[model samples]
Target: MMDALERVTGPANATPGAASSAIAPVLAGPPQPVRVLAAFPAAVYLEHATGLLAVVAADGVQHPNAVVLSVGVAARPLAGLHVGQEGTVGDGAIGVGQLQVTVARWFDPSPHLRATSPPLIAGKIADARAHLMARTGSDSHDLAVPADAVAEALRSGDMDGVLTAVRDLVGAGPGLTPAGDDVLAGLFAAVVTLSPAVAPEATTTLTRTLALTGGAVVDRARHVTTAVSAELLHHAVRGEVADLAAAVLHAFTGRRPLTPALDALLAVGATSGRDLAHGLITGAALVLATAEAGDPDRPATTVGAR
Candidate 1:
């Protein structure tokens, strides 16, 4: 039987303060996390390549929203089964404290996935490219050089080289969370989907790269990009062909503005939306470039190749 742990709505030590002007707006949205607590037991399942999907029980009750955990690693033993779990908050355990949560649902294809098709994917790629071209004149594109270098390093199995290229790309874009980081995150996700076997090593390199490029700003961008990219990659891993394609496609084509998932990424910062859009386009370009190169062990083609 699962252990019954008491659920504290917020931090055990927290007292509800009278709403004040300064703190009101920050608290306007969904509830925020409080104190750090012990790791409570949870039920874990694989959300395909997305990462761990965990339903932790608080007071032995299930939560409607399962926490989607993203770790850049290959498949684990829990790939398709439900099992008891416990882990640190930094690893994607969501709660105020050591709140126990139970899995309410896992990987339900978003309704948005239905709109995807090959032509849509192709069209979005074209549209995103055109958008970049229009934005910067002549389609020279954003992050083209570094993205290509990272892809080449991946194909060549040079994890260190990949890390260097990623750091350089992410370090230089505009905004608090440079747009390049988001695109790099997307590119990372695509590579993970196209080659699941490489994730463990790739993740190792990525973790180290992020460490070397440390800063409060970059860290924030990393957090948002990692989450967004993991979701996209997980959809691809599950063969949710339409939804996976739709996520990026919509970001570029915009028949619909931003999907709920993407919107969350955007809300991370002031310029997150614009940066994410640029990232999506650039990420797609990287994927197209690699796919067209036709060699898993060679440098990726340039965005202009197609």
Candidate 2:
């Protein structure tokens, strides 16, 4: 993406140069010429899946919603675009108001998945869980009961019970998005990966649940976020917990961590990280149990000190 941006800006013009003589400045004080390098018609959606304001073109190309032109906090150039405005973004003299895309300020959802000491990750998860339990009105128990039920249902290959358990848990917690939705996201991600037979009904139920609680705004956001999470969770279950760590991170921090994903999750809200961590752990455990129960001949994969 940087390479594409550089090609448009050119190497010599990467940094801000003097105002061009050809064009006059839009502002009164400084006569600066800002040239539009690249522009596209994009449907700006706050992807609740990863918490990014995805700017995808009609043809299905994703553009970087935020771009930094120079160094320091004052050099933010793309901060002035609006959701429904046809504006120019380019290399040249820019004013703060004209360039400010207030919505872009929220598009930092990427997961930081790095190789780390498994013990460190485990410890962080434990701390997150404890913190969540102590919070006022925390719904960990409310969420956990259905999770356990789902796991037990998966163990017995009881598809009916599994669907029922999942339905009971959907829209189960507080908040606009709800902790239950996050758990369902994690649980469904794992189930679809390990137990394909149950994926169809499980996904349908989850979609209905999201629609019921999310309303128009959240329902629209889920279109992107839920899909991205599912793919990441698939990658996670196939390998180590590290693979899905980004999925857990995206549930809270919005942006993926550049360091360890666990560190990102543990550093977030009063109980947001804790709740996501709980869902992730539960999803992973349920996947393992389902795999073991479904195929007794296949050796079970062990994770961490357990």
Candidate 3:
């Protein structure tokens, strides 16, 4: 649970408003955390004063339509707090608050939120972060793709070969690539040798490398690596400037830039192009689809008195 918050916070740090806006609506008002975890990628659980409302997203890649995950009749506020209040994020709990609760993927992969983890992912996340810091020459490592490896991987058809090589170098975090790893040394060299304007020249090489990596497993592996990277960025990106334009674009079109901070948090939040390609998948289940399982006119928005 703690790990998930830290992980997603990586990219969120770069784009504070975007991150804050994302969880704000869902945790609108206050109440006890009834459940946490995603059955789909772009899902949000809302615990308000009146009731427990599951926000059925309508974002294309994450939510094609609005659908509810679950609804609980709440006589009292969630997290034992007041209505219209937010929580302060902390180490153990999702955030320190007495209002609306925000549950993270780390706490509950299951819809039931029964299987709590031992925070082991925290260490793995730290290792990945340390690896990035050492190799990136700075806290951030975007634009530094291993061109030689990417070029070679492009020539080679073996996606596994590409990933194996990448794991060897950067040790995998955020948006790592097979070729990126094999030529990380060279990639860094290319960036350094070149002017600051072209420091991220490795990006072109990495894009080409992905074409060769091929298929589901490699793709999922990339996402997993991204999750790891996102966790590491928790320290690097937090409190930094966030890109609202980029975030909005991501929300509208399932694609995100190859940015380190963006990629890392996107993976952790499971909001990448790969994760929510349909704008209908939240963390685990398709709540929107489920909500409109039978009805055709899915209520787009609430008509409340302003």
Candidate 4:
């Protein structure tokens, strides 16, 4: 090896005793895709006989086990290694080793995954509904309405019933202000779009559920918000809605009301929501904007229609 000065110094400035020495490492082949586990702290090797080692080596989450092959980790991906191939994902590995044990670490589930515990008052969905209901008592008969009635209103197309029942539950006391703006934001979750004519019913179910579940409402809301937001960012702006966004919209709006949002959606010039479901989210946003624009009594779909 060259001396310290010879290595650090430029080739031209090499000392008389030391020969000019400057070497750089060469890059290997093209980048290869490596499988990574996101759930746990460490990665479980994709043992062939053993199957997908735990995606996450360690985690509170109950780990899903993989199937084992006869020989061992397949020489290459052999014997249909798709069974236990799910979990969080991260970067690829550097070099290759026998398909014995792969390594992995926990992929941070931040903005992607909603926080489960200590729900965000506004940021989380389920919690917002509860908060909103708590502030606004049920509007049904003074007698506590049966859960069946609540479920029925939601399950059947009883928008008016749901609104009236929930109104009774909330009672004449004070209004149930959602804990924060998060409540509205969280509405993105557990929401399905309906035909424009049926939007009132969808919102009715939505408001009722929020008041009832208390805790679950916020959690679900977070999930909805995240799912919908992601879809919008990727697909809607481009054009069509992504799978998740489409699903959420369908679920939240129901059949009757989403028609206008759908019409609005088809009208815009954009690509598909493959990257993100931006279009569907746009439809949802328009719903809110329309609601805010006027007629607290009027449904969001009516504005889109106009």
Candidate 5:
């Protein structure tokens, strides 16, 4: 299903040559044709021979493995494309079936949450949770049990507990990006990206912990989730996320307003936005707990206490 951003972007008459001068650097090597894995009104998922996934979005929302088309590109043409249709990506343009889109921009989707006092970070997280609950009118969802287990494990620094809960969460719900997988993606991205910022003093320990848990997530995800979701989880483990998810993280770091950024995220898929939000809040809370665990002076905190 198309997300809110895709629906809003809609279709436009594409002038592919108009932005020729502004095209960013193309991917390395000779162009290779990719198979369409899925096509939507404003987005197309493609698979390369190497098994890597790439997304082409008309809305210009960036992902680590995505190509943002120029605003002039017509999204309607993408909807007509079928899975397994041939496409070629290189030289700043993507040609799929009868549709072609010029690349206008590229970005690294990995989030960088700025370092701040733990108290300030905690307050930002609290505000995010409150805003989410107010918007959704609920603090928990269908996968709350496993989700809470993951958060609790993180809070107590129990790697074994985390892995056990993660096994239950992956591929547990419906959708191309299952609700459970979305939660895990959000959790992995938040924890991997925000840990160092919240606990600079514990960087070594955090890094090691992330490596072990992140590797486990990637390995298990491939076997349990859809190809698209598994790929997303792999990226999330490395701290890369969709633009909306990144916006929420940025807001938590005081880089943007919490309500608007979070509201935009909450508008995504049926429950994807809320599930990701829950995971983000859980992951943020975990950061605070982990940081406090390494520092005796910091006050104790529990996961999901909010």
Candidate 6:
């Protein structure tokens, strides 16, 4: 059984005269002690023993696992905390060492991306790809080979190939969230979330295959990547993505404008955004191919060679 803390929700522990802060509802896990993983001026990440990660951010971007503070909470206060410091979640606040942030409310991260016409989704995907290509130059370190392998595997419904490509990506780059891991996360989120819409008849088979793949990805990630990235992968497998990534997905399905959301995602950490965008595009394209493969009258869609 999953622990209550994993559920990430319960009544806040209210304290007298304490002000509440807004948290991404997903981050408000049951009150429990946590240890600081990393600390920066803009954000502090806390890790639960169960391997869940939560972030306290002083910015407007509401990461899936973040507790967003109001403007009143300055970056200076977060600067005082250090990695390895102990903390607690209670009294409607997240206390890390001497820093305490109360929970005022929990906000939904984004509207769920609903099913839309495949032609519209395809056009948005093309637009997003063009935007990414125009804005970012080629990188010598790009994960094109492994990413394509994964997309091709998904396109052909080859579970073994998917796992092999995913293994290659688990720890393939540098950073807290390595570029390869980001790609995998984006791919996993897109496949799990969009497959049903794109290929309704194959949904059952795809879901079973993805459940197996997602479990293996999480298991492999625990051994190969940073704990923060591993935790994020775990959530991604379950179709929970960072708000920035979710925005791009929203656009891909035609619920919102593609360029603005794509630009916002592209502006994330040096290469993380672009890598994620690539993965999202690849996964969406694979969905189109899978749909075509299931329909005799439709021409097979070519999964991108890039």
In terms of lDDT, the poorest run of 10 residues in model 2 is 19-28
What value does the lDDT take at residue 2 in candidate 6?
28
Q: Candidate 4 regions off by >4 Å?
A: 1-81, 84-279, 293-306
lDDT of 1 by residue, 1-306 (tens): 011111213233322211111111222323333322113233332232213233322222121123422211132212332223333222112332233332222333322322332234446667655654554454444566776676566555565676566666654555433556645545543333322222333334333332333333234333544433333233322322223333544454345553453444434445444454454454455444544445456564455343
Candidate 1 — worst ten consecutive residues by lDDT sum?
A: 16-25
lDDT of all the models against the reference? 0.38, 0.38, 0.27, 0.27, 0.71, 0.70
How well does each candidate superpose onto the true structure, as a TM-score? 0.41, 0.41, 0.23, 0.20, 0.84, 0.85
Candidate 6: global Cα-lDDT?
A: 0.70
**For model 6, what is the alpha-carbon lDDT of residue 201?**
74
CA displacement after TM-score superposition, residue 168 of candidate 1 (Å): 0.6
lDDT per residue for candidate 6 within 1-306, as digits (tens), equals: 123223343234421112112233223455677888887676678876566545445553455566666642354556678888887764345776666665555544433668776677778777777777688854223587788788777665678988888877888889988989988888878887788766767545655677877788798899989987887788777777777888888888887788999889988888888888888887787777677777788787777634
Count of clashes, each model: 9, 15, 40, 77, 0, 6
Name model 6 segments beyond 4 Å from true: 1-31, 72-75, 90-92, 108-111, 138-141
Candidate with more favorable, higher TM-score: 2 or 3: 2
Q: Which stretches of candidate 1 lie above 4 Å from their native place? A: 1-104, 107-122, 132-142, 170-176, 194-246, 249-269, 295-301, 304-306
Higher-lDDT candidate of 4 and 5: 5
Model 2 misplacement above 4 A: 1-78, 81-140, 153-163, 172-176, 190-244, 247-261, 294-306
**lDDT (Cα, tens digit) per residue for candidate 2, span 1-306:** 333222332124233322211111121122222333223333233322222222232222112222222233334333444434443323322322244221111112222334332233334445444454554345255677777776566545565566566666555556433566556555544443323322233234333332233233233334433433332232222321222344553332223432255445545445445555566656545444433434456554332112
Model 5: CA > 4 A from native: 1-26, 72-77, 90-93, 102-104, 154-159
Query: Residue 287 lDDT in model 2?
Result: 43
Residues 1-306 of candidate 5: C-alpha lDDT, one tens digit per residue: 112112221113432422211112233324677788877766677876554445454563455566655442363545578888997755555667677655443456777778866788799888887787788887777777787788777655578887888988999888888999989888878888888777866544545566678778778888888878887887788888888989988887888888898988888878888898888888887777778877789777776686
lDDT of 4 at 72: 28
| Model 2 residue 13 CA deviation in Å | 8.2
Weakest lDDT window of 10 consecutive positions for candidate 6? 14-23
